[model samples]
Target chain A: QTAATPAPAETWLPTLQVDTPQQGFDLAIVMARRAVKTTQPDVAVLKAQRPHYAGDAARLIDVSGVAAAWFATIAAANGYWRD
Target chain B: QTAATPAPAETWLPTLQVDTPQQGFDLAIVMARRAVKTTQPDVAVLKAQRPHYAGDAARLIDVSGVAAAWFATIAAANGYWRD
Candidate 1:
């Protein structure tokens, strides 16, 4: 007999009610901010261009750092991460 | 002499004004919705479980379809597509 897999909260968190409505909303907001940040480019890496915000170091985002941050936030928020 | 690369609007769209405030807000809302959807699991695939949403098909999102949809939206919104 084959053992069936169980539906853990980790797998279906988007609609699983893993968090309360307020908590979910808050998490969604936090995730949204990260997603927006992911779409930004790194100013230093693309520095050859006409630097629009040349002196503003705060506006850049390193592309390579995004995937790590994205998955980290998701896993951390959902309690799927291990120490 | 090495040719320097230019930062096109496509590269810096996250912080750059690729879209207007209203447009960006709308896009962000749209993107946020998609990101939330990405976190949802497909009901059909995970149907062996208790099926919290057994009768409802509308609540599900196919995982495979997400990447295509995601890139398409980003590319379309940013005018990166050539077709």
Candidate 2:
């Protein structure tokens, strides 16, 4: 009898269950939040940084552009705007 | 006085508010979800596509990689992994 194959090693981050494009995007956000939480556990520091960004229009635009690109990919995956 | 310049035409999409790196990332996720919902509002169609991706390892990896890149940007913005 052939030997049974061993299960693959676990990934550092397991694939999140997503039933729709919305879920997929939500998972991505969760992952990003987790990354930040893991790296910077201090709430005070996070709060301190908040005001600095409130009026930082340039950074705001940059971040939004990043989001737009990321969303574009998710939209494509869901076949949105497809001819 | 010079006539007040008309307010710049609104962008097609407005920037979301974010107080921290985590919030910024969360906003990205929200935008992505919105894009999908706006373009494809039918829940049934989204459900039908789920099975196709359940075992789509390649696509899963691709999506995760995209998330990783996105999270990395957020991390950098928050000074994570910085020397």
TM-score of each: 0.19, 0.32
Per-residue lDDT tens digits of candidate 1, residues B1-83?
Answer: 23576553232122212344445445434443333333323433333332432243432333223333433333444444333
Candidate 1 local lDDT, A2-82, one digit each (tens): 357655434323442333323433454455444554575564544554242222121111211222234334334544311
Separate clash counts for every candidate: 0, 0
**Mind listing the fnat for each candidate?**
0.00, 0.00
Worst 10 residues of 2 chain A by lDDT: A9-18
Off by over 4 Å in 2: A1-14, A66-83, B1-67, B70-83
Give Cα-based local distance difference scores for all models.
0.35, 0.47
lDDT of 2 by residue, A4-79 (tens): 8777533433333235777757645555334333434565654555554446676455444444545444444344
